[model samples]
Target: MRWNNATTGRWTHRLIPNLTPWLQRRHGQVDFYLTQMISGHGCFKEYLHRFKHEPNPYCDHCGTGSIEDAEHALFICPLFVRYRAEAETTTVCNLTADNVMSCTLESQSKWDAIANMAAGILKELRRRERSRRIQS
Candidate 1:
């Protein structure tokens, strides 16, 4: 079942090619940040827009007009560049959406650092989402 689903198709499935290992080795409980990052379901504009909850998919914080998908927000958005830098500095791993699952399984420190980064970014995004709702 695990090998059969390891297709280069869905974003989550691609990142997590082998589900058994990840499920067996994941440290700590899966939190809000991990859930959002892994599942690509959250307050992200791209997700909201896809589900008809948001008017557009563009990131409001970056002003780059890029789709606020999990990959763009976690890996490319300039708004979280500082967070990325700090996480990378601490983990010594170049963070990417594709590698986050593997990196988390590598060590406890890496997991904690990545989790911190994700939590910070998502919390800020959630705040912005609420602000956007109030403004609109």
Candidate 2:
């Protein structure tokens, strides 16, 4: 579902407050990832649904029948287990599934770690999905 301007405003400021400044300092692929997150698209299930890329919004990658949004990719996808663990350690405190959307990282190092992982997650997912398309 496309969010109206008012809703988007609240979501960005409340749930992901540091996103605008973070995007300002990044470019290329990292910028792309942050843009995708902010806009709620890019290889994620709900985005795919809007364009009808796939019939169902459930996450096929994890085989758990969950919606494969950015949150799932960052904090819960088994495919990125190692990266998630690393992201957790790089931050001041352990990162949890909910923290991806709720908590704010107050340090550049922590933000960088998560930002890198976010981009990597998109890269990996795009690669896998591309390969799946090729194979089929």
Give the Å shift of residue 45 in candidate 2.
Answer: 2.7
Top candidate, metric TM-score: 1
The per-candidate count of clashes, in order, stands at 0, 0
Flag regions of model 2 displaced more than 4 Å: 1-14, 17-30, 96-105
| Candidate number of the best lDDT | 1
In order of appearance, the predictions have TM-scores of 0.88, 0.71
**Candidate 1: C-alpha lDDT:** 0.83
User: Clash number for model 2?
Assistant: 0
Q: Which ten residues in a row have the lowest lDDT in candidate 2?
A: 21-30
Q: Which parts of model 1 are misplaced by more than 4 Å? A: 3-9, 62-65
Quote the RMSD, in angstroms, for model 1. 2.4
How well is each residue in 1-136 modelled by candidate 1, as lDDT tens digits? 4444444348788678787878799575678888888777877899999888889899876765688888888889988899899899988989887787788888888888888988988988899889888999
